[model samples]
Target: MSESDSPDDIGTSPDSLDLSPREPSARQRRQRRPWLAMIVLLLVVAAGGVVLTKFLTSAIDYYCNVDEIGAKEGCEAGRRLRIQGIVDVGSVTDNATATEFSMSFGGVSLPVVYEGEPGGIFKECIPVVVHGILRDGVFNGDRIEVKHSNEYEAENPDRIVGETDKGSECSQ
Candidate 1:
């Protein structure tokens, strides 16, 4: 044992002693930050997926003509849809509880059982749009829109109908 060596410095040499405070390197800083960043990124992605699914579901618009629906297999049971057709004359039967009718298009007929009142202009041979679902081969309708053609005009000089307040025009 050397006389100059003390018991307090038994195994450590002067070259091996590190007494300064350590500063973290760039790699260590990066490692500590990723866990928080990853959690935040995952939450953002999940929220985006939910919003996208909701938008797509609400934006869906499914509609078809009576003939097309009858001829194709795309209309699944219990799926809501819109059907465009001409109301058959004498086919409407309005009861105390419901209105049952038949519509025709391209020789295809669709039986509709509506639980609501038909529109004011609804009648034989009128173009209509029915909103409903097909159950047991019949349309269970909730709403009906009657489409009227513009046949009455304001400019016919020969007007053969009842007189209006014309204010001037009935003669050429």
Candidate 2:
């Protein structure tokens, strides 16, 4: 094809000859790239937000002694934490709805009101772990787990009989 060739020599339809405004293929792809990237980025960000929300919303299991309720960090009121203590002698009171009890640890007493009846040897002078939130000076417990795994009791099997006979010396 030389410059001398006329436009009539080349085949051209009436529609092709018309100067209609239409984007090129490369321009279309380029225009679509930003929207594609934005969708992918938005998906990634949304997935990240979901993961962060699950991590933040999940219950944090931080076990603390009853004495550390106000003394230790992350062991204050309004936060969910696990408190372990020996149930005070003659402290448990169970009604139709809930159970109220006081436990002692390191000379500090924490009064707890469990929403349900505790099972598995939940008795006076027994070490128990309660999971709940501390609100308005009292622990609002929803679950109770008696700490039955004691190293001393495990090692001194013979002393268990005498100890049970004498009962716990965990004074209030």
Candidate 3:
């Protein structure tokens, strides 16, 4: 209650007053501004690398025809494939464990063994795409995509076998 002590100076002390602004720590710097952008960019690059690896490893599958099995570059054994061929008449045999069949194209037959039943218009004398890997001489297939009547006629309307076309390397 002294007269020299004003209301403003009553509660203030020199030891307690610190008005200088201090630099932020390294942790604080990482949580704001350019560091944030760098962090985001790093994450984006990591994700892109993962996607590219997945695409190169499995997504880029090889497609070929029945006659191109051993001759094609990507149609070798121990790799994934999409082989297209016509289902030979009376070659489909569905036992309890699998469906075994032979597909013919370029007058060559490729034996396929699928582990499951195919759906959506699959039958004899039709073109199909078999997805799987070739082990030895047999194709260990997992899926069958029948190029049904409508799709076949629409896509290959003029695919005629004539004297000029490669006459059956398979046929003697």
Candidate 4:
């Protein structure tokens, strides 16, 4: 066939075709719109999830140093809370039924009461985190998580030295 005989061969050649100027059809545009909408929806959902997670975590987590708990208002009575402090000297009172202790962080001291058997590391001067609620004027603790400071004893090289054994010498 002659080079200019057919209209279908206007932008095409036998060896190479130049079909770069074609406009997209209506069906192609419609198909792309849904995909774009889906991407926007996914981004919105992810952002909402992040905000919800932050709100939930903040509502559940609570931390208060011993002094902060005492000086602040509305701290003496509340829901479950966490208090961090060092055990006061001669403040641990253990009996057959329960263990009562007091801790000092900064200038404040708060009493902690635990009903279960105290751990081996439960002693005066050790750092601890008490978990419970404050009812009336006292902290009614259900669980205590003791965290002893790192200490090394030269006399006892075989045994690990912990703050619980040191006995109430920690400074506020």
Candidate 5:
């Protein structure tokens, strides 16, 4: 066989068949890994921020009997809440504009300023749930719920004798 035509190839070696070069070096791969980790961390932080915002924005409304509002702790002012009590009959003072009124709760006798129209159940001697926030040593109510015991008698057959009858009577 001629030297140039030899089957034991010369230029056609396995090393010459490598077309794809410039494969990423270990250093380059290591550098890219940090960026990938940073991206994952950023995504996690963003997700946590969203969850925290939702939790903070979720209004926490709670019911407190008359005595709780006048406690030493003062019912944690600035949080939305409902204070249940008897509407102080004569204690309700209608503002000159008639759009606002002030009522008092029994026991603590804390004065609550209410804005907006009062409901039909807003009468005196009724169990009331005032919705608002306790701020500056007073209850600023935006909505009021007057719950009567008789209203629940038909719905709850096993009604107690004095379940809704609890609370103070307004002092005229």
Candidate 6:
């Protein structure tokens, strides 16, 4: 048969073809369900956020100061807490199993017994955050996080560490 008589050769020109828009297939409709996809994504994200908040809250320990300890209930019942205070000078005693010291804030003092290794920053008058439980008028600290302020030299070379001297060369 001639090439023109073949079915494959039918309507080869652009004008002879049916070019109108066609309805989408089932597969295409399912793939393009934006509302369903968005709802699923939102549910997953909300569940993840709720789980993260619960985990973080359970892991955190609340912090308070020495002066607040007297007014805080459940302190002496061995409840785990984070207490911030300054180490009292000449109050540290190093022992075999533990290091005992007194930390004071606002004239309120509390004894602390730490059995863990105190870091190099542990010194008299240094601020620290102790994580442990309070019992029998003493805080049994299992962990210590030292809080050190930033060290910056003022413009004046002869003045105190952070003090500014008007006549010093730093003003220039």
TM-score of each model, paired residue for residue: 0.50, 0.54, 0.52, 0.52, 0.45, 0.54
RMSD of 4: 8.9
Worst 10 residues of 4 by lDDT: 10-19
lDDT of 3 by residue, 1-172 (tens): 4456666774586533445665889998776888778899999999999999989965675368988877877776677888999887678899998999889888788899999898878877778899999887898899999885544335686787675443322121
lDDT of each: 0.77, 0.81, 0.79, 0.73, 0.66, 0.77
> CA lDDT of 10 in candidate 1?
61
Pairs that collide in candidate 6 are none
Candidate 5 residue runs with Cα over 4 Å from true position: 1-62, 70-75, 96-106, 151-172
Model 5, backbone clash pairs (residues 3+ apart or across chains), number = 0
Q: Which candidate leads the pack in lDDT? A: 2
Evaluate model 5: give its TM-score: 0.45
| lDDT, candidate 5, 1-172, per-residue tens | 2334455564576554445656789998888898899999999999999888877754343467767754625365576767887766456667754333344454466677787668765776667788888777678888888776744434677776473454344433
Worst 10 residues of 5 by lDDT: 163-172
True-vs-predicted CA distance for residue 92, candidate 4, Å: 1.2
Model 3 TM-score is 0.52
What's the C-alpha lDDT at position 59 in model 2?
42
- Model 3 C-alpha RMSD to native: 9.3
TM-score of 2: 0.54
| Clashing pairs in model 1, backbone N/Cα/C closer than 3 A | none
lDDT ranking, best first: 2, 3, 1, 6, 4, 5
Model 1 lDDT per residue over 1-172, tens place:
4456677766676733445656889998888998899999999999999988977864354457888884556545567888878888678899998999898887788999999789769877778889889999899999998877777657888866554432222121
Quickly count the clashes in candidate 2.
0
